[model samples]
Target: YRTAAASASLPTFLLVGPSGSGKTAFATLTERTSIAQTHTSTQPLTIEALLPSPHVPASSHYRSPGDPAYERSRRFLLLDTPGHGKLRHYATASLSDPKSIRGIIFVVDAAALAEEPGLNEAASYLHDVLLSLQKRYTSATSSKGPTGIPVLVAANKMDLFTALPANLVKHQLEKAITEVRTSRAKALRDAGAALSGGEDEVDEEREWLGEGGEGHFEFSQMQEIGTSVSVVGANVLGGKETGSVDGWWEWIGENL
Candidate 1:
């Protein structure tokens, strides 16, 4: 039991995104050192993985590679949740109960994000994820507040010719999330208006993401709530034999 508890307490990173956005591919590559032919996952998968060589964990950067503490710091759990719409409760549950969660990796198909439908789907899911984080921060009762959970927007499939660059991915997502925020607030108001009484007034403030203003929603806005967002471009396949996820791994090392 003690052994199991120790392993369970390892820092965990949540992997979430829209379907076919390469969440499973990234997980498989990280676990096996090679990408496999992955199908759409319907269930959440948890795997123990080590941070690869040459990239030291931020927590133990000063220690030499052979040190036991340095090696132990590289240990962590990768929790890959299903990206399918109906299967997202696993991700939501993890967010709500993020005891061991160190960070969130939201993978996106850079090329798909260039189109309207794909962009909207990714943006909508991302909006909800960030909103949950915002709510978690605002609802904390302690003076120091809860520990911040940073986010990494992994822009996958960068090898694709049509893939949007990392900067454009960041810009477009912010724009789409702004629209999603507006429509969601409008929806809440419409629903409340349809009701006769104000007995159950909707808490729009709680539902609103970022500062309550008419301005656009940027990832920077999350800073006020203690969550930092970053977008890094990478390819899980198509570049070289193994593809380039060095940037993603580096980001993970930094956060680790």
Candidate 2:
């Protein structure tokens, strides 16, 4: 976790997750549209689109909503990325670029797991996206930034499909998270070695970590941090999780 010093600008966070995983909803919650505004509108608002590249006009705009809270800040730019399976394809590149993202919020839909078609599949894809993003962020940084870019694993929409155990989901995700962390730790080690003075970058020596590298992929395990909550989510976050109630405030403050 990295905090923006008092003099520094507020940290900008980018939201990414599978379709129907409520990435947009989580953004709405973070933006705090309802409380920030006199009332909440059902209408969908345009959240703005990001081009594949930073320069020039956006060829397209992905739609997301905004109310008083989100509009209040110029810093938070949540990318409504396309859903998983296919969308996950672009994530590695986007994250590697660094120019487009500051922090990543990987949303997984807990309620969707039981559903037959969309929800379950979406949930699974979202989970994979989290794994990939977690790996990429760790790999790119290797803990080198002045303030490390934070990644929040958001379990969204716990209001539905309350049956599945948290342990189960965490089990499936563990391997992926470990791999990413391992890759990143290896990257950092290589970067450190490369910085040694008066040494030519060696081909074989750079391969020290093997293809992906070594170590473990980990985060303060996934947290239920979105505004809209499920019975399952409420039970998990409100009841057990340390940061559920004030999760956003604490996380934002820490990562800002």
Candidate 3:
């Protein structure tokens, strides 16, 4: 009964990332089919969206276009959460209990990721998101384990001259995430010591973002826990010559 209700819900994709990363822009473009001027979001927004033409949902590839089930499979929900540091609780809460969430799209400004602060902030937030997913996967009691909720690292603002290419964006993020994982583990150890008045085993394995080792963190490591991470580049705004997100839409279609 409960499982059936959950299965009947729309396939939802949660849009998350740091502020000014074009999350709202991409969300609006996806919902409206054209870019609109968007202000920073103060609250979460939910929008119903259909897969655009020329992109077929993976689940409906064998069905004809006119089939109602095929069309219905193309429909899903885009849940945009506030990306501000103080308002990210909405995203975290949603991740903690992802009832209908089918995927996560973490939008990031490609240009911003070229700098130190922007890179660090994005990496930190991504680390925590991945960790939450890890916890969910590892703690599942079901013999079959939890369903994998894949992640799409949407590299946005490709129109900017400073924007990193999609490949570099992936590499940079992986490198930065390695640092984030190390720092986080160290912080957890220190906190545990302070609380216990001595060194103590904190079960760091559960908190670690990827395979436990000194090896560089790669998104592929997530596959062990059932999640797959992909990085796709697209631009939501910046005029006729540099505005498009077909890659993102296609990725969404594949997942849908």
Candidate 4:
């Protein structure tokens, strides 16, 4: 979960959704084929200020499918914004570099959340992108404490069918991480403030929103069997703890 020693101001990831929820191949199909790590040369990682507005639907751009010089250097600056309620009316996302917009994935389509979770519209665009990400990182970390911006709501495709099934997506992500850790520990114990997962859990949580994972994922119920680990996206097509979760080696490890 990246024990931040430094080097965290380089995360400009924003990939809204709607049409073909792959967000324009998420940087050459999952960041150059399942999140790159193959070195070469010619540099191709410098995505900044990705403005996406025009009715949020597939605004393609996934460079290096096999040509156009490569060398990626452990890079990740993807942005395919657009598809926020089919444009031509309401809109947002136009705030320059708030330390690289830290995080916001919001890419869900799970057969439209199994046909109706909130009268589906991707659950009203994931509750308006989680209330605009808890009100823009609680006003950008209300005096800098949320630690370098973070937010990730990825519910993408779900293998394009039958909707959620990773144990009902880990019982709806363990009931929203136990209601966002007791509502941020009762809003920091009613003002006294001093928590992350609130008071104690030891692992200061690494990934929940700005996914890619590090640690923290509760919700179980298929215990009789063995091997467990879930919450979704590991090429899931019915994978309750790595069983036969299909390919991409289980893509939902956000921050891990």
Candidate 5:
């Protein structure tokens, strides 16, 4: 039980995204250092992963490579949650109580963001994740606020010719999330009108993600809530014999 307790306390990074976005692939790669055949996951999988060498964990940069403390600092857990709509409660559950969570790695299929349906699906899921973080930040009882959780928008599958570039991916998601935010507000207002109650006003404000206003949603707004969102592009498969995810590892190391 002591071993289990120690493992449970390891820093965890939540892996979430839409179906077929390579969340499992990345998890597999992190565990084994090579890609493996993956299927649509219906349940959450937790794997212990160590930060690869050459990239140093931010917390242990001063320690020598061979030091035991340095080695321990490189250890963390990757909580890969199912991306299917029906199974997203696993992801939502983790977000709701993220005590040991170090960060969130939201994988996205770069090519899929090129189409409307895919873009909208990804946007809606992402909007909720950000809003959850925003709610956590606002509802904290401590004066200093809860520790911020950063999000890495991992733009996977860059090898595909149709894949949108990283910059475009960021822009498209921001624009789509803006539309989602607008629609959600309108929905709340409509529902409140139907109910004819003053209590609904407070709920609407709580539901709104980021700053309130007419301006479109930008990831920068999340900084106000102590969350930083970054979009980095890399192919988890098909780029070469071994797909590139060095950028992702570096980001993880930074957070670690």
Candidate 6:
């Protein structure tokens, strides 16, 4: 029981995104070092994985291989949450629970992101995730503030010819999230007015995402809220060529 408890306390990276976005594929690959066929996940899955070679965990940079500290530093947990809209309570629980969460990896299909529905879906989910982190940061009671959580937007499916480049993926998501933020604020105002008969003003600042003003929303705004968002492109199951996901692993290592 003591051994199990110690293992369960390892730093965890939450894997979340829209369905069919390669979240399972990436998770499976990270655990087995090989891609495997996957079906749409219906529940959250947690797996223990180690940092592969040539890449070093930030905490183990000075420690050489074979050292106990270096080996322990490579050990961490990857929590894969179902991306389906109706089943996101699992992710919500993880986010709300006080655990050893280190970072979040949001996987998205680059090819699908080209369409309106896909972009909107990804943007909405991402907005909520970032807002949760923001709320957590602001609600902390510590004088020094809580440890900030970083986010990695893994733009997957680059092997497909229709996929958007990494830069466009970042831009498109930012633009779509701006629209989502505006619409959400409007809805909140309407609901608040209905409840108070327009006698009370809504707290737009609390509901608003990023900085105030008509300016576009950028990931950099998250920096002020104790979260750093990074968009990195990689494919987990490339045909004819080996898939590349080293960048994501490096990001995970840095956070771990």
Q: What is the lDDT of candidate 1?
A: 0.91
Better TM-score candidate (4, 6): 6
All-Cα superposition RMSD per candidate: 2.0, 13.7, 3.1, 17.0, 1.9, 1.7
Off by over 4 Å in 6: 239-243
Per-residue lDDT tens digits for candidate 3, residues 196-248, read 88995688889888898887999999999899999998888886587578888
Q: What is candidate 5's CA lDDT for residue 83?
A: 96
Query: How does each model score on lDDT?
Result: 0.91, 0.42, 0.91, 0.39, 0.93, 0.89
Instruction: Compose the digit string of candidate 2's lDDT tens values, residues 1-256.
Output: 3253521333345556556566555455544535232122222232432212122121112322254333233233455455545555455555555454556666556555444553445434434444444444344544452233456555554444462344444443444445444554556567757787433344432222223334542334323111111111221222233224244333433343
**Residue pairs in collision within model 1:** none
| Winner by lDDT between candidate 6 and candidate 4 | 6
Instruction: Give TM-scores for every candidate, taking all chains together and pairing residue i with residue i.
Output: 0.95, 0.45, 0.94, 0.27, 0.95, 0.95
Can you give the lDDT of residue 248 in candidate 6?
A: 93
lDDT of 1 by residue, 1-256 (tens): 3387777988999999999999988888877855589999999998888899888899998899889899889988889999999999999999998868999999999999999899999999999999999999999999999999999999999888899999999999999999999999988887887784554367899999999888899999999998999999999988665358888888889989
lDDT of 6 by residue, 1-256 (tens): 3388888989999999998999989888877745688999998999888888888999988889999889899988889999999999998889986347999999999999999799999999999998888878777888888888899999999999999999999999999999999899889988888999974378777678888887799999999977899999999888537358888989998987
Runs of candidate 4 exceeding 4 Å displacement? 1-26, 30-103, 106-132, 137-152, 156-167, 190-256
| TM-score, prediction 3 | 0.94
The prediction achieving the highest lDDT against the true structure is 5
Q: Order candidates by lDDT, high to low.
A: 5, 1, 3, 6, 2, 4
Between candidates 3 and 5, name the one with more favorable lDDT.
Answer: 5
Give the residue spans of candidate 2 off by over 4 A: 1-10, 29-75, 88-93, 113-147, 161-168, 175-246
Error of 5 at 224 (Å): 0.4
